[model samples]
Target chain A: MAHSSETLNPFENLRLELRRGCLVLAVLAELRSEQYGYTLRKALAEHGMAIDEGTLYPLLRRLENQGLLVSEWREEDKRNKRFYRLSPDGKLILKQLLAEWQSMNASLNGIF
Target chain B: MELLDRYLQAVKFWLPKAQKQDIIAELSEDICSQIEEKETELGRKLNEAEVEAILKQLGRPLLVANRYLPQQYLIGPVLFPIYRFVLKIVGLCYLVPWVLVWIGLMTFGLSDRAQHPSGSLIGALASLWGPLWLAAFFAFGVVTIVFAILERSQAKSRFLEDWDPRKLPPVRDPNQISRASSIFELAANTVFCMWWVGIRSPIIVLGQSAARITLAPAWRYFFWGFLFLAFANIATSGVNLLRPHWTRARASVRLVTDVIGVALFCWLCKAGILVEISIPTVAPAKTLEIANAINLWMSRSFPIVFIVGVVIAALDVHRIVRVKTADTRPLRGVAAAGGLPQQ
Candidate 1:
């Protein structure tokens, strides 16, 4: 079976490189309210950014590791689930990133 | 459910040791939610095949596990361009010279060791290939290891930051002649011209033997012509040392001199018995035999010399084209720096 990162076509590889940065902003934006792994994937997919289960789990771990996100295991529906939310640092960084994104988008529109 | 248990176990086996139980617990929760969602739609629990399909969608156990760990490679993208440059440096500066020396040894040195059968030169060359490839492989391995360590350490950025563009060597021009080489050629040609002028009899005594070798009377036709070509060569070399560039005038002079030199070689080549033994009075046949043997070596060497002269003349023709192109090329830096008068 092909692995998650294996043999993406040329267009797919480029699309992935373009999407990698946006996914971080998207995750931080959605984690404003607390959500667990499955629900977060469902929410992102509902909002037109379907992430792979493999890709989402590790990205959450990395963000938590970097102090941009915080996670805690809590009991729900008789089984334990890891819940995640953006940290205060994440909120500050996200605001800066959104401003940067808007300025860049306006510059690109001017060029176009 | 059993298949799901086995799938989670496979993934857990490859996860980082400290985080295995925690990651597996979260992954198990996600998979359970997925299966529960599917069962609600189907109005029953998922079969074994359905469980396998869901696990396949998550991806390979190792790949899913690997994403949580830090990225690893022998050389990462940042240092890869420099890695390629180092490899080319190894090829040009290291491997090429070693291969050339091996070729030189086979041609000049080892040929002497191989007794006179020219075919043995090829055999001697074949024997060295194994060792040459082994040395190249060893060099490649060492460069890769050094680059790998640099990629992983903090020193990569420091090495890049410390580089000075000003210290790079100046760009080389192909048409420019080396002053040192021109000087050496001029000196050697001057000595040759002097030796040619001092020889009155044109006689070559073979050591203390009475078997003296004398130039045939036919050589008298080419002596003055040969001396004139030598003087012309010396003049060209002298001019090159001062200017150090392949100007059209210098190339023309060298071409004309080479044409005349080649004419002399072709003219002398026709003078069939160019050398003869002056004293073989006792046996006329033996005298002819010894002279034939000496002339045989001469016959083999002159064609190689003739071909080399032709090739040099061809190169001078190319140099003339280069000189014309160099004339047309704009002096950009000189113009920008206000070194040239305003147009």
Candidate 2:
């Protein structure tokens, strides 16, 4: 017998929910260093947090729309590219998020 | 490359009109970058099959575009439960009653209605169908629209959050009757009592007797008995409202009252000539015949009241037995435990 793609695991659903919030935090942290869409994706993949392009692009646009990030279309490597970087608000938000994350991590470590 | 362009075009078609071009262009540039990296790895240009693999990994065009749109619903999640509740009430109060009455008329009223040209069973059912369907549709549509508007209005308001859990109704035991149903019964009994008192004289007067009928003189005697039963029902409803639970004593009272009611209605059924229609203008024989016809109608209806009363009385008996069994079971458990050694 073989497992098929249609087979669902409850653990996978829960893990996806856990990862969703982390992905937003990871994207904001990465945008501290300016990068184009492809390089940012490659960089995140290198760090072992692999987000698909569909989710990544929509999330980028959403974050930019919320004024946490800014983007510009410019010539890079002789091709038109949209570069993204953190805004002033993005830095402040990132600091708050990281503090919350660290406090939760410490508390979880203590409990475990 | 052509296949890639077509995929991007398909994705763009689903994207918002304002950002479609910009999104597609950015997506195209990213795909081209990935293809170039892959080619560099392979040490050669990639074929169509290789490109298609990359596209499949990226995701289907519709799914990718859908992610860009915010979630949408006719009635949003916040208002959905309330909307469902309102529909259920409509079903219970309006639709269920309508269906029951339709069934009753089909079962009983068909022969009486057959004198009319359009009163065949199928025709009567079809006539009911049109109104029932239209009424249900309109009821649902109106409720949906109201909730959709409410959803929009409450989206930014604290209407949901402002509610306190303490203000919510307390949980009740399954054995206990709901206060709402008890209140409804109380109101209904009160109405019946009032109608029983006032309807007699008006019915005898020909100014507005629809059936031109009169209750038999025996009903004048039967009235006090029926009114006693009505008061008993009202008293039980009040008891439930105050106590909000059933006990053996309460169940016994209900059982006794229902048995008395069944007896009273049975006495009324045996009472002579329950309905009369006297028309002085008509011939005396015709008047008696008219009176007999109404009497026949009343007699036909008597068995229904008897059956309903008997069912009510039987249910009360069942309830009383149940309460007794329930009362004894816990005590029996306690006694058994007392006999055992302490742990």
**RMSD to native for every prediction?**
7.9, 7.8
Interface Cα RMSD for candidate 2?
A: 0.9
Q: What's model 2's TM-score?
A: 0.69
TM-score of chain B of 1: 0.51
Estimate the TM-score of every prediction. 0.63, 0.69
List fnat, each candidate: 0.89, 0.79
- What lDDT is reached at residue B37 by model 1? 98
Candidate 2 lDDT, B69-179, residue by residue in tens: 887777877788889999999987777667655645554654544754687777666677778899899989999999988887788684877887899975433457779
In candidate 2, the residue pairs with backbone N, CA or C atoms under 3 Å apart (3 or more residues apart, or in different chains) clash, namely: none
In terms of lDDT, the poorest run of 10 residues in model 1 chain B is B110-119
Task: Classify candidate 1 by CAPRI docking class.
Answer: medium
Q: What share of the true interface contacts does candidate 1 keep?
A: 0.89
